[model samples]
Target: MNPRRQVTEHLLRTYKSALIGFAGVFVVGVVIADIVAARVADPAPGIWMYVAIAFRYWVGIIAVIFISNNLRQFVAVGVTRRDFMAGATAVGVLASVAFAVFVPLGHGIEYAIHGGSGFSAATGFREFAATLVSCLASFVAGSAACAGIYRFGAWGGLALVIPALLPAAAATIFLTTDSDGQIAADHLSFPLALVVCLVATAAVAVLSHWELKDVTIRRSALG
Candidate 1:
């Protein structure tokens, strides 16, 4: 089978199960956390509870990406670098769109439960864009790492994801945890995101060259 079809089919099959599990887990976790927080602190609606729910989904998105990458290896079937990059991007983009809606919706939920809005629509949109970039970075890195693993077994390939994640992670820590509310890079971070992208591409290229050098090209043989 062609790499495109192979990757797409695998992604669909894997993520379908992931979606089911995610809904069940996410909903249950959120509800439990919310209930517990309500009992512990503030009277009626709780802002912290809503924030917790939002953070849970944010983390959930990353978990899905990681699982999909690991699943690529767990399955006996082979996947190409092109397949990994392309397929993972599609999934990441879908998740990014969800994040776009989720952030604002969470804010809206907060407004409904609590009295005033903690953030304005514009700020929410900015954060959404940053979050999208983060997800994209993660997807590209994940696919590259998976491709490397497919070529070099486990340890060597796993190293590939690290370089790709560094800059993006640096960007994440700086923007996410800072007291300031800006999205633009600061000092060294100005080139951090770009560097990560470049490193990730290099890793993908190296591993992919090896993987394609002697393609196993699985055949549908005698029945």
Candidate 2:
């Protein structure tokens, strides 16, 4: 296997337990909620919609750990900084895609559990697309934030905070799902919002690479 592919697999293996736990917990919780809601009131918009929203935040934290914690460890193991960033980026995007697929699929399962035909093809597609881009934005933004803090001191990192968070913030503000599981954007067209989010995410991912590529790994107490 290629070095980058090996790094990607290694990172994924390290995160496998967390990833499974995340999805498993969400699944169990949503099922319980659906049953309770069916007994009391109709569950609006399905639990998966809310799960989709949480996915971005969850992946964002993962991205931070991928950089702040894993970067130095991977580099110490003879991996190039460039390869580490590439592998991490690939992992982030793949994780986002997985959540995107899961959200819509879970929505359908929620409908099945509720004994309701609440699932709509159009809504599912909208949810999938929105979640994918938003999570991507969140992941990349997190990477940028951590890269800034890792390469520069805390004070210097503060300077890049706003721009580093722009993609995730904008995605959260614009692409929103309603109570009925329908997605809508605040100001821009839905498609346009996705495009802008993708562009911003790409830019920030590049910036994170630039910041991390030649980063100086400071000595720690363990070493």
Candidate 3:
């Protein structure tokens, strides 16, 4: 009936399975996507880099999805915002290194044939800043989803990601005319998305915490 003991074990089992499933999906999805893209279109320069970027981007989302579904059980003082940030930094650093190594090698054929990775090549602070911002955007969105889904429930989290996306989804259908490429880099609307996502996350976190306050383990055990 110890809350800490129960929650810690719960988090470990849930996250372990989620992480493994995510990895399997990522590997299968990327390998197939790469082979198909190679066969279909003789893409422009940087195509391989594009492939690498696509995989990494999608995997990041998938990671967030898993974390979102399972983090709420462990959000005590030790897992506060500061602690989350520190952990995120360590994860980000490791991921970035892996990307740097794998990308050049994996996309070697595409580069050898076409030339470069057509994606935005970050050279200076501006590039670094942009990358950081995108990561922040994902963090906010993921945090919100995590709080809503994990703390509250899946249905509650879906309520948030869906409703928040409505306006943007409508505008995307209305404004985007230049193929589907720029749609992925939709920076102009990211701030709005971040706000929506974070608000939803925080709301769910606060409410769920309040809802369960009186039902803590000691109270439950005595009952």
The global C-alpha lDDT for each of the candidates, from Candidate 1 onward, is: 0.48, 0.81, 0.40
For TM-score, candidate 1 versus 2, the one ahead is 2
For 1-223, candidate 3 gives per-residue lDDT tens digits of 5444444444445445664565466556656665666677666323333333343343345335434432332444344433343344345344434444444444444444444343233222222322333333333344444444544455755776554333223333322212111334455464464454345434543443343343222211112
Winner on lDDT between 2 and 3 is 2
Q: Tell me the tens digit of each residue's lDDT in model 1 across 1-223.
A: 6665565566667666766475566556655655675677665343432332243234334433543443345234556545654554455567656655665555445545543424566756655554555545554444444445555556765666575345345435444412112344454452464455445445544544454344333221100
**Best lDDT goes to which candidate?**
2
In angstroms, give how far residue 140 of model 2 lies from its true place.
0.5
Model 1 steric clash pairs: none
Candidate 2 lDDT over residue span 1-223, tens digit each:
6778988999899998988997898888877776776677654435567655788788899898887788888879898888887788889889999988988888877776675436789978988998899889999899889878777767788788778998998888777776446665568888898898888988887888788778888553112
Among residues 3 or more apart in sequence or in different chains, the pairs in candidate 2 whose N, CA or C atoms overlap within 3 Å are none
Worst 10 residues of 1 by lDDT: 214-223
Score candidate 3 by lDDT. 0.40
- Model 1 misplacement above 4 A: 1-10, 43-85, 115-117, 177-223
Relative to the true structure, candidate 3 reaches a TM of 0.41
> How are the candidates ranked when ordered by TM-score, highest leading?
2, 1, 3
Top-scoring candidate (TM-score): 2
TM-score of each: 0.58, 0.92, 0.41
Which pairs in model 3 have colliding backbones?
46-116, 46-117, 46-118
